[model samples]
Target chain A: MAGEVKFGILSCANIARTLISAMKLLPEVKIHAIASRSLDKVQSFAAANDVPKETKLYGSYEELLDDDEVDALYVPLPTGLHVEWVLKAAAKKKHILIEKPPAHTVKELDVMLEALQKNGLQYMDGTMWMHHPRTHKMEAVLHDSSTIGRICEVHSTFNYSAEVAYRRKGGLSADVRGNPNLDGLGALGDIGWYCVRGILWAYDYEMPKSVTAHPGASYNEKGVIVSCGATFVWEDGRTATFTTSFNTGHVMKLLVVGVNGSLENDDFVLPARADRAGFKVVSNTSWKDVLGGWNRTEDVQEVTLEIPQEAHMVREFARLVASIRDGSGAVEPRWAEISRKTQVLLDAVKESIENGLKTIDV
Target chain B: MAGEVKFGILSCANIARTLISAMKLLPEVKIHAIASRSLDKVQSFAAANDVPKETKLYGSYEELLDDDEVDALYVPLPTGLHVEWVLKAAAKKKHILIEKPPAHTVKELDVMLEALQKNGLQYMDGTMWMHHPRTHKMEAVLHDSSTIGRICEVHSTFNYSAEVAYRRKGGLSADVRGNPNLDGLGALGDIGWYCVRGILWAYDYEMPKSVTAHPGASYNEKGVIVSCGATFVWEDGRTATFTTSFNTGHVMKLLVVGVNGSLENDDFVLPARADRAGFKVVSNTSWKDVLGGWNRTEDVQEVTLEIPQEAHMVREFARLVASIRDGSGAVEPRWAEISRKTQVLLDAVKESIENGLKTIDV
Candidate 1:
């Protein structure tokens, strides 16, 4: 426990509550501090969530960063604020775990990543599903040429209907995600981030040659994208597509098709159950003789987990933090690299949407 | 049985063999004749498929069409030949069940359809899944607002890897689907027809305002498209996308997302089993409190069938033919209209692909 990574949560955002609960399962991770612009809000959040009595509560993010006991920070601020707080956290030598759509653009993210690298601080975007055991199993199948052959296409979707209260407000200006000033990327940055990441992960992070936005993207009154989709094409004829929205029913699906097989998971971002996650794989698929039906149906594969995916994410992040703290490893660049590629594609999609849905060179 | 519709088979194509087998289950249908360019080939096919001893065998399509006993024609000729044979069949007053991508172009299909309409002949394309009981069940869910409200997006894919012998021929020109002179549209016309039809079916035959082909369409040496995708956008902001290929594993997936729910089926085109077909639906989908996992997972709904979908298709066609022959009904316009809309979209996709992936007005 001496090398425990103490996490100072920078906001009382709803997502932070989930992270706090996940951290509870890891001894290597400690909820060292909670901070908010409002001291009363931080106090209520901590007391309501049963935060340890000894854990520090800060009225401002600066106070938490200045706390010598806090070794890392979980910045769940609006995307617009990531660069500012992340740069400040790196300056303070705090390892950072930030929310996704890591920045408004790849250039913005590169600045923060550079600062984190210079400070020898660990950095990872909070894409919890990346750490799930099921994800690893799916990857194993994807990598096996005999199982999937050469990757041909990938399709991912992440969508959810906004609450009635949010939609009834007319402009949804009150919600950070729908407010252009707070999260300009809107649904694309919030939920679409997961879809873009899922597609990239299936392709093993190979950068697509071009990105084209599908037409008819829905936008809020403030010109923030509420729903949109885009297609990605690789130089080798492999293609991928993703759709994201805050104006549709919840759906998190990822499908990867290859020359000989396919893999699909409906709850790729978050499983239907915390105790286990499942995906369906169909290998060497063909029609039955005489074309009556399929010769073989997809097999549903499940991976049971001792802890939820979010907890696994916390444990993994903490393990990296601990290694860096003990001088046993340099900062892991894989997470930062993945986040950068996702952000790059996210920016390309936005660019394509803005420019008459023309295909953008990635 | 006195008014049984006698169907004349055109060519000994592999698909015709399946149709002949399906027709065996329909007492209202009788195989009156089998035809091919070669009399020996037709004789071999009739023998191999166990055609009834009384059925006629013809050395040419014209000879079969001339047989007065044949009330309808099952035309499984390559797409390039549809216009010629379909027009000839209409002139002969034979009801027609032609294979999909009914013609290479909508103009050609329009000519054939006009001739059929003027001749008072029943016309239907060979899209077997449309006749499946499971398709009706899935449609009921899609139409129910409470189950899946306000459809927003649809995605369909129909892909199958070419046989090794076809690919080993260096250009796949040996296969009709891969030969520009025979089926120039190639995958887009063959498998892609199902995807376009599936999308149109999901949208209730509503015509899209625009169609845009995705980049990276693969082609054989003869300039026939072997793989491609396209996006369709409606006037009401509903969007649909489809991918089809002869260079990937078998995949028949359809996903429809609405404001309140979603429906998905992996085997949308062909069921994995002949006796039962299934689709999954998730209503009012939402994340669990605290964003842990899905509140409710998709429920797989299966519809048991008394006969295979192909048999269902054959029976339905036969019923229509019987009705027309018995003076109980005139030619049904619904089937022709559905086929027309699908062909229009299919042509638009090809035009878009040929025109630098431009967005084409539907």
Candidate 2:
């Protein structure tokens, strides 16, 4: 790996696995250290994985946060624990990649964002699917003016079988998703946030001025709310509505309907989707992207889609780390900002659902 | 038009004009007479349209309703007036096609249904687009099973531009669209009802168990409601969410996304959109009646679609009339029950919105 960026990960969580696998495939990055709360746990993880800096056991999270060799911190804790760790990492001057649902509420997110800027630390939100090359291709294809029509409405959805939708040890219910105190926010926070973020990314992403929702009512055995929905309105008079449910079956999709035509896609469960005769441009994001399905007669065009063997998030993260170390520009800096806004909107929606879905000023 | 069905309209309104133009397109039907409360209006309309038999004139709606010569009724009056006319037409044993937002509440809808059955009268809700050729193609593509995946979720939207949405002078909003006294229901009934009806048409008549909504508090300057929304769950575990706005710039859309792929279309509007890949199809509804899109797709294997002309609605309406006389199976008869159910669900939603969105029994 020439001119490589040395990276150290602090957990053996799913997100850690995603990052490590991607690191394995890239030449511009190297795994330097593996840390865990227990020395034995860290040693086993390091043994199966390649890390030049060996296994470092930290009985306390503070030890890892204070380690100077760790140029960036990857926090994949529960949604409830994000702010506490993000601020701790920011204080140590480490660049951060916090997993989705960056915080339980915007107030918590505000604290984390404030700390990042105050410490002059570079930061990014780890909303994985956003980094996919398909997203870039969609953005470009949708912006193809030759096809005609501005997108007037965006309809995004992702439903799941209620049983499989439940949290690690629980059943599917609104309490699991709606209780900000328990799940930090439910369906939208976990995956739907990505759907909404995808819409913003595909569009120029001007924030909506007003948001209100009619979310499904979810309840745990003890009776707590866990499911709901929210709609937002943009200034130029476009509207975006989203639904996140733990009680429904598998759905991972985002649809952007334009006046002239429409485009859509899904990640994790489904690939990119769009009207075949409208437009299909080359992938724009630095990841594997594919596009094809056209009608040459009516001037409709398409491009062949390509998917890299590795996950898109991993690819983008490695590049981001390398850019920082080499003093180069960010690979996709807007991702972090989009993630922030997505989080903020999700937080407001939670409030709207909790307080009778009142229209909130975005 | 020898021995053919003679169509005599009961209003001088826009929808009546549409029906008149539509009947003109149907060789099996003829606009024999038009009755209004004002003879001057009738004479002017008759003279301008060159009708050989305008039935002179009628100063009262009952005179028109009791006319032995008129076989069926197409009631496109104020929303508040739908129930009364439906009951009268049914009692008279006239096959009836009433404008949507059939009644202001579920109780009214139930009574209307009961009346139609009690009198052995055939009935149809004028959701003409459900029978559009392109809609038929869209349905076929959705159920193609070969391309579309398991149905995930459906998001249906129908909005008309504020300035162009309603009855201007003695318009329906003040007389029918949103006035509980006239329109009988708000956004859901006036336009959103079609979305609900479309879903039933798309999903082979699968019905949701419970419904909920969060209606906007927006009102036109003259006190007409301009927007509202609802989210419903089917007993089979599928979920549906819909929105209808009269204040926004005009737009109408219907989207069905499945596990492997999806179906996208704006069948009501010209330049009808069709289908896209990677979107799933969960509905049991066959593509037997699916509509085609504007231009054909080059990759016809996965991207099939149908486009229709504006007269599509005219042709569909004529089918309803032919179905009653020629018995062509009642113009998608199953939709009548769905429309009644939709009205009930809408009533419950309105009650919920007024009471902080409390969940109501279906």
Candidate 3:
């Protein structure tokens, strides 16, 4: 129980490299093994990433899951494969740190969550920004009534252009994210997940009454969403909107406006800097006497991190896993709940987009 | 024609004070007269604002229009009065500098523009931000394909909390902007004008194909909109969204994302400082090799102004008037065209909100 938590990664995804790097920075966590369907890819990935010598390599995922040394699993597989591998990992009694857009739908996520819950496993999504100290600092300001008051509106966007590469690879049909057989949700699942999660996080995970996908959603030849936007309306008249795309320049922005103030961050999904991050907060904003200018300027509040946000995620996930393994604590339901809420909203947005952009009740 | 262009005030509204102050700063412009429906109000406003001793005082707007020495009129009256006064001013052959939300509808604006065109008078709106040097600099970035590339998306918001004051004044019924018989359009016309104009300006005045008002638009008891949002879709897949309110804290933000880059300005409507304004631009954005951070940081580009934006606006207006009166130029139609386009979109958003949040074709 006092030893480090062992993590076995289930794929050779580009994102897995980031997780492995983060694990290397945490003293309480260790990358115990890695696997891919092809032995050559696993060996090359391990070598390229400088995986520890003691870490085992498996050509098949089943072999890694059978290794009792791996107390927890980091599943960075395609969203379409999450349900299959996550259920298998849960049956092996492994705590999970899964990639986002956790599954193709909330139903799939729920089935996987039930298995983990029954096995008493710690479960958390791979939204690293949520683990950043800057996030918690911003939350403190949002929670303080005098600082931001009641949130009235929110807008978030996460976009990056992937069209150039997709075209070079003989169009979107060859892209993993654009292939319905591999990642069916396309841009909505791969990137829009961050925007939806950001809106839910800003609202403290309260589900919206209705979700309406903005019109003109772009789709690939295979009918996978390439770009989309949606609006969320709550029962109390509060509202939020988000946009995600694989056809625009990289942009990650989150703006939350309250009755008394507002807060904004340009890098809500990933910090532009690794050691420190900041957000702008302006409270009690008022005009200079004759409206020539604002009475107060936006204040930039920065939080310094000893390590990167992904490292923080690894440390937090390991701490939870350690507690559960030592019988010192029960499984934390908050993480799964957050992931479920995000997936539910993502599903609602997809439904609205598919149903002629109709308003879908959550 | 060699003398300074003389200006007459059409109302003693609060905003006229700022215009008067701006006129005082420009050597080519002179405040020749002040007028209001009430003599006492006009006299008090002139005294309070330190009007020149030679400036004439009129008890009625009709008298100000009849003044032979006044070359132009600055109309800052309520939105409902624009069509009437603007047409009257045009008939008198006076150059006009009108406040924004040019008219209640595009049809009314067209009628006013027609009158102005027939009279051969220069027509310009009082959107001071457009005249700022910073605006031109940002435009340069937008026009350069390498900097921001083809504009893909835009999000603008201009909100100010007037709820506390409105509640104190008998629940919005007694408020000027909330009064259906006066401003009529409420927050949408009053503050949303800036957001609509901002979006139009960012898109270089291209009209969108359709507009859909987001749900949960709040309205007063008299059916005046207090808060609202809308999404705009262009034929080429470029899109924009905007939100305006009298129920949230002060916020003026314009974010434009392009295929290769993005630009954002927090104080787009009114700069945070009078002497300087700035915007953040980031081009060719990409993640670092291992996704630890961004490869480049957003650059803050600032432009210093020799005078306030309002002063620059007055100076520009006077220049155009001087050119027209001297037989050196004709009325510039660009200003009127921009105003008309913004009004058309604003009308569409209002229509969408009124008709059950339907998507209205532009």
Candidate 4:
């Protein structure tokens, strides 16, 4: 069904600039089109990101969806507008690579998933870290029982200082994250998405038995959550906790504790040093050495990537699309499974927050 | 009364060996006696650590207490034995420097406190890390609003791989932590004690309004806790979470987040490097640089100590005892306040765990 995978990016959102630029680096994919409601925005974004001259520019999302040249669509629209555009793109029989918080809610995501299934197209959320080589290496260490043993606990936090910019631009009403009509879930959808994904990923996407949101949540004038935290418990006694905020300095951390060892990385969402990514692993530590002295050693392992994580993400998505188009493989269900689990957890946290911090079953 | 502060060792517990050695290094303090029920144990402990020839040796704790030359007693005993011996030491009018878990419960601790008050004795717990100069330096950074701003959240953890040793020594009945009749509160009194103290210390001994213990604690055959975690919330919406265990590899970390910055260290309970102490401070971390680019810089500040932290703890206790004896100053109430708060929080966590993880008010 395919010769080369071509991507059509929907919306000229600022994030789309990075996505398009990363996609341009993948040999398996070509930038096929750029679409927006405003022709000027499409032209400017396409030109600014150095989208290939062969790439078409469409004034409307529907016009790009109707084009036969686009084998897949990358939707980086605002959360509130994702359902409509994602569904339209999926209905056009294009494989979908959608931005995080693929939709505002699980119900909206379900509709998009159904369209992708009915049209026989592939789908994966654009979580760049997942495709990083460092991530894979860390995963190996975590699952290696001899080194890490069974995972006992995990703690992840994703926070950023975004409020100052919102205030400088005008006020809460003018802020996309602060506006209830735009990104209604605010920090929960924006930053908490990564946190929930991290916890689920650590446990191989095993759903938690229950999730209890911690009581206090900071909200904007529009009544959207800007900061929150939660604790989760699995059936077999494993536990995970996470905090997400827009009120603190930027910090992205993930710590996984095991019986024999632990893995920790502060810049889990984004590599700390862009050229190389690293994580610390300390295994089989003892207060006293076998020869009778204290021994404390930790190995900091780094994985250098020729391509940045964002580009690796684009390459992986392109490869998956290529496989499906060439009748080589079926869409990977793991991606959708984790994405749904993340939303389920997010929904439970929101539910717990709304209902006086009750424990909600995942 | 204060020519040189004299200290009596209550028992030849493994920890006493370290405390006595630290005490020997302090010129202002004299090791007056070493005591244990077994004469062989006391003699070997005293000689192995090179107690001075003038230091008295006692075959029983009672003989040590009766020694008129010993001005103070260092009680490094099991949790269940603390209340009985602490009250006994106080009744003899000896100033006290006790190890962690001063008593099994807060009520027991209150009785010991009453004894100290009745006997006009100076008291301090052997929480060595508290006496480290590095701790005070980090405290300054946390309290400095211009740099770190207001403390909003804290995450502290203290865990060690003690299970292998426990098993090697022959299972639950032989393990003090596993025997409910000995260290009754188990991991809560052992590791969780330090985690709770770290959180309380970070907030200047302010008690949390509520504490909810996380479920799924691992226990030995005797049903004593081995691993557990909890979430705490203050009246002002400041939050803290902690996890403590004997099942995992050693990890002692404390991360304090502020509005403008954060202070983090992995060796809060024990310095990672004994010769020097360090903590990372990331202050005034705006999302962008002053010139408008991403800027993330963390400064590692280290404070070198002429004496180890344990020596500093002994020296501090001796100073307090000296002040009491020479009419220089009364005992510092601050140490007792923080110790009591730590016990209260520990009691609350135990209560929550016993009550099936109910949210308990402190």
Top TM-score model? 1
Candidate 3 residues A1-362, lDDT tens each? 25899999999998999998888888898889999998999999999999999989999999999999999999999888999999999999999999987888999999999999999999999999999999999999899888879998999999888775467676556877988877899999888998888898899989999999888798888889999999999999999999888987789889999998899988888988898899999886777755367865568999988899999999999999998888887898999999999999999999988887788998
Ranking by TM-score: 1, 3, 4, 2
Query: For this target, which candidate reaches the highest DockQ against the unseen true structure?
Result: 1
Question: Please, what is the whole-model Cα lDDT of each candidate in the order they appear?
Answer: 0.88, 0.59, 0.88, 0.82
List model 4 lDDT by residue over B1-362, tens digit each. Answer: 25789989898877887787687778899888889998898888878877789888889999998988889999888888988888888888999898888877899988998889888898888788899999999888877788767787888888877766567787545777778877887888887898899898899888889998776677777888888888898897788888888777777889888777788888787776667888998765654311112346789999987778888898888888988888998877777778888989998988887886788987
Q: Give the CA lDDT, 0 to 100, for residue B103 in model 2.
A: 77
Off by over 4 Å in 3: A164-173, B164-173
Residue B157, model 3: lDDT of 89
DockQ per candidate: 0.67, 0.10, 0.65, 0.40
Model 3, B1-362: lDDT tens digits are 25799999999987899899888888888899999998999998888888888889999999999998889999999888988898888888899999876788899889999999999989999999999999999999999888879998998888887765456676566777887777888888888888889888999999999999888789888888899989899998889988888888888989999988799998887897888899999876877756467754578999998888999899988999999999998788899989888889889999988887788999
Q: How does each model score on TM-score? A: 0.98, 0.69, 0.97, 0.94
lDDT of 1 by residue, A197-283 (tens): 999999999999999998778898889998899999999889998888787788888989988888989889999888988998898
- Model 4 - which docking category? acceptable
| Worst lDDT 10-window in candidate 4 chain B | B286-295
Interface RMSD of 4: 4.3
Model 3: share of true interface contacts reproduced: 0.63
Ranking of models by DockQ: 1, 3, 4, 2
Supply the TM-score of chain A against the true chain A for every candidate structure. Answer: 0.97, 0.79, 0.96, 0.94
